[model samples]
Target: TEIFDGFSKTVSKCKFIPVVCGSSLENGGISNLLEIIAKSFPSYISKKHFKAISKQDNKEMQIEISENGNFCGFCFKTVLDQFNGKLSFIRVLNGEIKKDDEVLIVEKNNKFKVTKILQPFGNKIEEMEKGVTGDIIVLQKLDDISTTYTIGSKDISYTYAFDKLPQPVYSVAISAKDKNTEDKLISTLHKFSEEDPTLIVKYDPETKQNVISGMGELHLEVYFSKIRKQLKLEFETSIPRINYKETITKQVESRYKHKKQSGGHGQYGEVAIRVSPNKRGEGFKFVNSIVGGVIPKQYIPGVEKGLIEGLNNGVLGKFPIIDIIVELFDGSYHEVDSSEMSFKIAARQALKDAMTKGDPILLEPIMNLSVYAMDKYTGDIISDLNGKRGKILGMDPIPGGLTLIKAEVPHSELLRYATDLKSITQGTASFELEFSHYSPITGKLAEQVIEERKKFITAEEEE
Candidate 1:
């Protein structure tokens, strides 16, 4: 009893977490840990109030954590059971809730009845009639309920603040092996994403592949393993291709005339455009500088549309073009032979002609990388990143003899970094990646990217 008192004082006064070590496989010391937690932890009533946002006035407020107040809680975790459907595990912060009570999903403003509340016991659960303050209860059949969602009684109109999810750093292109189960695979992946918001699944239109992204390789593999076991589905996964962009370096003026004379009314249109490099990341812009009705106003939209469409496939590697401005300064049209189609064709040709001479270059996505590893492995980490064309920003010695290494690396070079880092640090290091900006690639690297793009296009055409 004296030792327990000292430990509790240390925890409450110093805000320190007492570590309880035990072997889960052996089930040793488990009961003692549980007893300590139940006895030493402070009751919910002791926590005077919880911070929350009032939805009614969009202001910050506090909700008292007491059984006398209206029921309010937030979902901390979710589980999708094949037999029982979605189960939302909520930590009640205020008041008490009973079966058949209507509660509002604060964020969604939707009401749902408390159908069945259960207390989880390892792999099983036991039904409960009512849940009060500080109780962690699992509510079954809340299909739309997700993790971090705030729930409150009809009278309560406040939501607890939850931390935002981190951005996914690793990705893999996935495809169903059977092809017939593609829809099922996507639907199942979506359901899994709902259970864990960190897992993201989407289709990449540029690469024409379905991609699944998560925290790391292991994080993605766990979901894949679950899908394989639960649905008996076969799937293939590969490193996703980098989404490189194309841009020009110089300005050039070009013109194109489309004339086809075969029938009574032949198609005829001419376009003159000045293509100039815009500021980086400003995206594509179109300007019309025509006067005296050189090109009819009606056909101007067609010319703009043509230039925009032309950007989808740049002259260098067919990647989408960005940060370029196209100005329609001069053009001509025949009264009877000219049409929007003819102008569109001419405008597209003109842009293509200008791009080929404007010194086009490939731009690769740059990622801001932060690596956390032991100081002993810092040298190896720096050397490996330098070999991968990473620019080391700096390194700081953090607590626990760990170093935080920050760097900027190209996305293509990081496709397999998660696996490589594990091997390099023996699973003692971790890293985060976020897109920084697009940087131009030149010389052999640019040539290789263009060549690979050509091969991809040819293979796709053949298929």
Candidate 2:
């Protein structure tokens, strides 16, 4: 057979043919033909006459034509069915699978039953009872199964971990249009994220909004469209807010007292705390430096807890506080009136007082940005980046007249950078951004941010 002769020579040479079969008298397809050659005629691709495709001539590549063995499947995508919750699309790499068979989730280290199996033909599905190696099948109601999970047996301890997708480069704040659908929106978002590894959904406590991020704006748009079609939920999305940090610069001492007198009992607690700035990114630190029972040991945790709550929002712009150390030196407490609640209040007030007097400042998140553009647009791209308060780090030239530009830019200035770059380069330039470090923002920009936050809060109150 001329087909057998051509396939044997191609495998021996290890050459990648663009189209293996065109107009032919073949039975099944190219895959079935390869299987026949591998199993029935393994000698056709003997090592003696083989050429390595990856330049690893010394390495032995096992070509197994598995017919009916242990169940080994790799899940790549998931589809939502009307009757069943989720149907995982899996390609059986080795072994045969049947309905009601139990398989081990390799990565999760859990066992799940294959409830109902189906074969996908285009957009339609037909009930399937058994599937062999190299056949694509679907299993119903595997809720916990996600993309790239290996479904196999415990006896055969082999798992395949696919390469992870790239991190999301764009984000937008999302909220359900109807308050009643908010819970359902979040649940559906999580389910969509399981199917698409590039989709990321997280809650931003700073702005009190749900954020959906992906590789680009279009990626998120597609997800939102699918959600609307499948779950019949509408969402409102806007630019995500920047999460700024607040920190102190100088050491300061603060003393606060909580005194309340009621008919039954009185509350009295006093605390003295020394606040100092720590190293950048060191976060918060609480130290108890009491001696001679000035402040009782039992109530010390109350002080720390109060201080932690205070750290959630700083005096400047109410942002999260970071890189600060608080030392509890000395304080006076009443034997009968002092309690954890009183101490907590006193500690909270003391920390806030210290921060206000300690020269608090606002810090904005910086992003490490890398832009790839053709040489013709490098100058324009760099100029546009500079306008966004970006600091150029370095530049490198590569083949095809492409230049790579690396820089650091503030996250606030990049909310719409993806769209702007596409417009500037006419869809020829691309860039990726990642969180770097927090840097201080001063003068007009800081004042503007505070003003905007106040307006946002006021609008929420009105609503």
Candidate 3:
């Protein structure tokens, strides 16, 4: 009986339990020494001998051991406690874990020492020194740990992959009411995103707002509401502006000379570059074709870097410039004043001039949407989608009188669509949206977008 209690204590310390059973008729009086050895099984034993333990054949019952040793646990959930700071809820899969053991979060390439392990007992938590396979324990001070991380021992070779968390589809542009709350709100949003993988926080340059994306509208509303109630933080949010892109339609050559003389060395550089339209989705490409040392190699990277950064704010509506190739063919540099800074300024000026002559056009993001609703609201859903420049692929019928409608709609049209769909379907419909590809905007719609963008920029400049 002492052996049984000792075995339990040892198992509790190691965070795992090994079951060793044998018939009384055979292997009679297996010593308590076996229990001491069981605590270190698979880890302490040689791989060859450990594998052999499972092959033992006997007339009576046999206790087999495994070789791979339990060393698997993933951080499934995280919570913030007023006293504890941060806690990671980990479920052990294959190996034992102890309070002082060092485990690697293979995904994050981070090593953390388990400060304190606690096992949940209903509403309260009890300190646990060790937990073997099949035991769930909570560890503190795992601030960087998240649902995507897999915790294992240092020697483990295999990396455990946690299930893919849900991706955020609906995004809202959020901003604090006052400047004082902005810093605190940003910090809290980062912590919220770390705690919940489904929550995403990003700053949108186009809209100039901090955007928080989540699985659905309700999911994001719950998070913002919780912040307002618990943290006494107040913020307002609206649908974000669509991030459009500008690309060229033809190849054009342009030249720019940047000469500025101040108190210090005068800046003087001349650059000639060719801009060409690339295939959709090819992104931006830079090539230095300078021969006979038209431009020094050292300054060539400056031109490229300048062009790349310059593309972030495009000519049309300040969107990113994409799907274009810029070639630096010829340039002149002044011996006394020419430097990387001068060449960079010349390159940006040349690019802007070339883009103006290269027939720049706007590209909008299209999203593939899947809508699930009852048959009664199918007509209304189709009509609404069509009005938003959606192209319906097809409609499939499912069981329970539900219809699945698939369509590709422009991203701008779907910003406030979640609420609209709910109203149209009377809360009986749900939908999902994912980015598909960039499509060209032309005619009156393109003109309207350009005008709005110019007006926005003018207002911002005045502010």
Candidate 4:
């Protein structure tokens, strides 16, 4: 009793959290943990109000937490059941809810009928006719519902402000072992992503792979384990490829002539173009310098189209080219034989020739990375980042004996950083990264990337 009282006092003072060790699999210390929570945790009624956004006025407002008000709550979690379909777990913050009541999903602005109100106890669930304020209930068969969506009694037009999900740091490119099950695998992954907002699933068009990202390695492993157990399907996972770009470093002029004399009207088109580097991030620019009807106006679109298509695959590594200017200054056409198709071929060939001589280089995406860890592990963390080719920007000491280390690192180098950081800090740190900019890549590292790309292309062709 004395220990319980002391723990309660310390928790109430916001000094520390009381920890209760338990194993859910064995049901060890479960009852004691529940008892402590019931006795020590603050009641929901004690929370005065919740901040929410008014959709009508686009302003923030406070919603009072009272049992007499209209029904208001939010979905905190969701689960997919084979037999019951999607089940959304909601915490009722105000008023009451009954079976068949229509509720509004604030974010989606859609209404859904509550078919069954259920109360969960471990693995068992009991049907309830109604749920009152402060009760956590499950609604069955809410297929379109997702976590963090506000639920109100069809009248409130406010969305409760919820904490945002952290950025996913670890990623893997996944595919079904059997091609026949690929569609099913993708559909199931989407369902899982809907249930857990932190789990991100997307198809990378550049890499041509289905990628899934999450908080860390174990987080992804848990989903994969669940998927295997549920679907009984074979799956393959690999490290995702970084999306690199290509650009020119200098100006070069090239010419190409498309001509064929095997048919009645032989194709004929000739083009001269100058390619030069543009300011970074400006993307591809097309400038037509044709004068006095040289390279007729009708074929200009075809030339531009050809140039854009040429940018799709750079000579260095077949990566998309960016931040370059192509000037179509001179060309010749046979009035009887020249056509848009002929000009397109000529322009495409010209751009390819120019790129090969324009001092082309590969560009890799850089990420702005911020790591938070205890001060004692700062040296180890910095050392690891240095080894990954990370450029340290600065470090600031934060509260709680922690430090925030800021750096810019190439995206390819940090592919497994989530696991690496955990190992370096003994799982005592967290990090977030976002796309910063594209930087030039050269030398041995660039050679390795280009070689890997070649291997991937070869494997894809063989497949």
Query: Considering every candidate listed, which one attains the maximal TM-score?
Result: 1
Task: Compute the lDDT for candidate 2.
Answer: 0.84
Scored against the true structure, residue 160 in model 1 reaches a CA lDDT of: 90
Error of 4 at 147 (Å): 2.0
Please provide the root mean square deviation of candidate 2 (C-alpha atoms, Å): 6.2
For model 1, residues 215-264, the per-residue Cα lDDT tens digits are: 88889989999889989999999989889999889999999999999979
Q: Pick the candidate with the highest lDDT.
A: 4
> Model 4 over residues 1-463: C-alpha lDDT tens digits?
7876787777866887878898999999999999988988767787778788899998989989988899998899998887877888999988899999999888888898887899988888899999888899998887667898888887898988887789999999999999999999999999989888999999999999999999999999998998899889899999999999999899999999999988699998999999999998899999999999989999999999889888888998899999999999999999899999999999899988998998989999999999999999999999988998999999999999999999999999899999899898999999999999999999999999999999999999999
Better of 1 and 2 by lDDT: 1
Instruction: Name the regions of candidate 2 deviating beyond 4 angstroms.
Output: 1-72, 93-100, 127-133, 155-159, 226-235
For model 3, residues 321-390, the per-residue Cα lDDT tens digits are: 9999998889888878889989888898889888889888899999999998999999999999999999
Ranked by TM-score from best down, the candidates are 1, 4, 2, 3
Query: For model 3, where is the 10-residue window of minimal lDDT?
Result: 47-56
Candidate 2, which ten residues in sequence have the lowest lDDT sum?
Answer: 47-56
**Candidate 1: residue pairs that collide:** none
lDDT of 3: 0.80
Off by over 4 Å in 1: 1-5, 12-15, 51-71, 95-102, 109-118, 126-130, 153-159, 164-166, 257-270, 333-345
Q: List the residue pairs that clash in candidate 4.
A: none
The CA lDDT of each predicted structure is 0.90, 0.84, 0.80, 0.91
CA shift at 209, candidate 4, in angstroms? 2.0
